[model samples]
Target chain A: MIALSINWHAEDQAWLLVAQNRRGLPFGIGGSQLVAGGALLALSAPMAGRVASWAAVNPHDPTPLLRPPAWDDAVVAAAILGAALLLALLSRWTERLGLRTMLEMRSEEGREPLVGPVSVTLGPDRATIRGATWEASYDAALLTGIEEPPGYLILRFGAARPVMLPRRDLTEPDAAAVRDWAAGVLGHDDAAP
Target chain B: MNEVSSGTPPRRPWERPVTPPSARPAGLWTSPAPDRGPVLVVRVDTEDEVAASRLAVAAMTPRGGLGSAALGGLVMLTAVTAVLASGSGWKSPVPEGLPLLAILAAIAAFAGLGWLAGAYLLPLVRRWASVAHARRVLRPGPDGVPPDGGGPARVVLGTRALHWTGPRAARRFDVALLRGLVEDRDHMMLRFGLVSVVVLPRRDLAPEQQEAVRDWVRRHAREGRA
Candidate 1:
């Protein structure tokens, strides 16, 4: 388990979720996405340069493009375009899957990324989050695994990704108790991994 | 005088004229401070000292909501243009520009942009002007006197003493006396006791100058509470 920094803020959980959600979106889907798209487009720049050179040499030939090894050029152009589209779609799909997994795990763990203070209650087979703005409960049996990463407590509930909770809000004594509690509850289930 | 009287008078129009040495102004005082550093050093004549200091403090006056106001105006302009472009049979605001009124709408949108620029950007320019004015007023000319000489006083800020030199002068105010720093409209007030000095824009100050002020006030603020 990584020791949490004293300067950390509890509300950082909201920002972490936001960052995670942003990460789930593929490159070229929002701001700064254009850089990746532009790089992909540049891959075809050499072919474009060749086309420009060919057109300049055959200025009088209106059908210069048609005069080329037509089938090969068409196939190459189509393949490049197809590759670009396929990559973009794949990126978008993976991001969405990651976002879904995070959200699902968050729901199962009965935690939410919000600004207000949060309190928790854990029993033999259930967990509850009492937030200033919201309250939620979850079946503790759904907790599949727990990862005690540095500065964070991540709980996995049958999702590809886990729900992260920053440990900044917890005092040293409280952190130790929570750590012990998690170790006991997840001890049997986490044994598989 | 002899050349003029002896008819060796002014040469050809192409020739330059010799002028007498200009007499320097009296009672002018220039501070012994260095102005080439990161610190904002202003040398004001004793007479203009207070007003000039006020103007300097005014420079720190924060202009609030300028960004939001500009953005809102831009969004409104875009919405108006989009509406005008659609030609959705909406009545023309400036009826004579045409039945379509697109050109008139564009003109009106541009006018709104102009207004936004004037309202938000002009104050920023004015704040810089105040800083420049203070700097010029404070910088002593070759004669060991401020160019805009009026008094014998000098105030050197962002310096070792944060010194003010003159009669009845509070020569130095320890950073510990820095009670608070705040902005009021177009002027920033640096409070000490119940008094505050207006100063220039924070952006106009060199990074070191800004940091010096920040460190001074912040350290003092923490100490004062203790």
Candidate 2:
């Protein structure tokens, strides 16, 4: 089996920032809807008066008399506001579920980085990583994906924190070997030449 | 000495030398400074500010399903309310002229709310305002010097911190405190904390300098842990 070992870190900050931003999304949506609904409710009466005066001035016109129902207007506004609130709640619940999954995966303390460098061994079909106090192995099929962002190669597993391998510390051959192994396992065509 | 022993284990592929070949060398504008170590000075212009403004707007914009749905719902409801109030005639408890006043009020309210929510007008206004501000603040005087007695608008990357000095603004942030680095096709945003961010145009830096910046962050992160 083709295997390689390297020091790696967890991209904790990026994960945290993303989670923080996601947490605010539902609130932003709900608040905007509330303001819009309230404004519409407040303006319903005056709008009725304007249409009435315009009809009276054009008495000779053949247009039918139009009547605005305040109660119906209020109901429509409330219904839309309620729908928005429901969507926001649904979004919040989904975010929480994702967060819970991530937290559960993170409960495996051995997967996290220790004060010293963590050792990661990447093989053809599986990988083993060990910190100061614990060790774990993950099947290649279970990994979600791999991303090459600038200076680091990130191995993602669902919503969990990604394993980041700094490219600067790897030999070109070692990096190529790891990339090829991952590409083969993940069924990707972008393996290093 | 005549003991049967297994021969030395075959060398593993990963046991090879770890040092990678050096990246291609590129020229950078650097100068010596007093206590800050080697400083890389990057000139800023209107184009850079425009890129930064675009990045800021993108960062502020919401993403994903629900956030977009909510924004869409807001717009739809606003339109529905305006149509119902203006076109339909409702029996008013008050006066006939008041309905016209209500329609005007509704329009004003929706416009204000949309701007505050950053759903429509705010981003456009912010982009325009930022570009205008950049033009005024980054404008150099006749001698190519800033009018506020500070140097021309430039971003200085130092060993310890990143410094941004313009005619109206001077800010310094420690490199070690950098929380995250987010990048797009055209720009990179260096996030210092939850609220503070420095957007830099990617075209301003050479490939080597970009790598150097990433190396600096990785080195500091390790050192901080130590």
Candidate 3:
């Protein structure tokens, strides 16, 4: 079994599932970054060359994507690496800030691709769920909307895709507590798997 | 009423006629293919009531659903990097080693994006696989059942046969048998233990074809009413 670091929490009144390919703690994380960089370097090298060629052809336009301005491969690689880092940082930071208002969830308008013992938790009606998906709700009514899903449950809006809530693994009565609450909302029953 | 040569032939996965003679319902009906209202036979299994309700609610949700982790993950990955770079002085402390951090950031971002993308893609693939696999398991549509297989002219299931297959692995019920992986949430599943239905004229099916299928299933089998 591939070991992935997954954390389950609540963000924006929704559940979140997070997984990364990092092994161990502390320094191992730093190594993971290097792996990511290697991938980026592999991708950007070709892109850099393509950009340089594009520059030769389209001399007038912005022509920014075409290769780096330096002669040394390392220099060009650094520039690309730097850009990827900045983008990654910016994307991550921006994604976090997005949790507050959830202005545009277009990026999150789908299902997660994980198959395993997913985790779960109950948040204050208005609490935001913290996982691969970041949703916040304002009331307990959100729980009512919960339904059994293929893998996990998201319960953000009307009739969304099914999700596998960790509750199923719980004993009948325990699971029923949550299931009953949810059934009241979706207006259906799912007492069993 | 307008009756235009309506009747369908019987069909099933097994070579033997799976449709029960006693399963016929008294009423009008329609065909899966428009204008081909031929008489058809279908075998529906009755599932457990509690389980049926559970499965129905579960089915109502499409498949491979995602919650709010997308945004949360994006925020967390950024926070980790920023706190390190800005607080620890890694952001601009040394340009050389900074490359490593940057590389890490990209992976985090891609992984997050990939996770969300998988949610959508996985379900779609799983659904297709289930339908195809179901077709394979119940070969009557191909083998004994003619290409012009018969459909339920009108099916009315009884309450005693509402059993869901509960994800059978060909031989018996298992979580792996269901619309699995993406669709089954890693659990093999098949529905039907106890259920009941009453088949009726399908031409009267107002909305979706899925409704027609349900109508057929209901007619064939159902849970014993409480």
| Each prediction's DockQ against the real complex | 0.01, 0.02, 0.02
* TM-score head-to-head 2 vs 3, winner: 2
All candidates' lDDT scores? Answer: 0.41, 0.47, 0.32
Q: Is candidate 1 or candidate 2 better by DockQ?
A: 2
Per-residue lDDT of candidate 3, residues B7-126 (tens digit): 445342222222333322211011111122122223222111122223333353344323323432443344344434444323333346544544354445545544554456433443
lDDT of 3 by residue, A92-176 (tens): 3343454322312321322221222233344322222223322111233323245454444344322111233443245556456
Model 1 chain B: which ten-residue window has the lowest total lDDT? B20-29
State each model's TM-score restricted to chain B: 0.32, 0.41, 0.32
Regions of model 3 farther than 4 Å from truth: A1-193, B1-89, B93-115, B139-154, B157-226
Off by over 4 Å in 2: A1-193, B1-41, B57-68, B71-125, B141-172, B182-186, B193-201, B215-226
What lDDT tens digits, residue by residue, belong to model 2 across residues B92-208?
A: 454667555654544455444434444543344445544444454344433343222333434555555555544333345555445555577876666553334566667666665
Across residues A151-190, which tens digit of lDDT does each residue of candidate 2 receive?
7677753222255667876788867876776777767423
Better of 2 and 3 by lDDT: 2
TM-score of candidate 1 relative to the true fold: 0.29
* Candidate with maximal TM-score: 2
Ordering by lDDT: 2, 1, 3
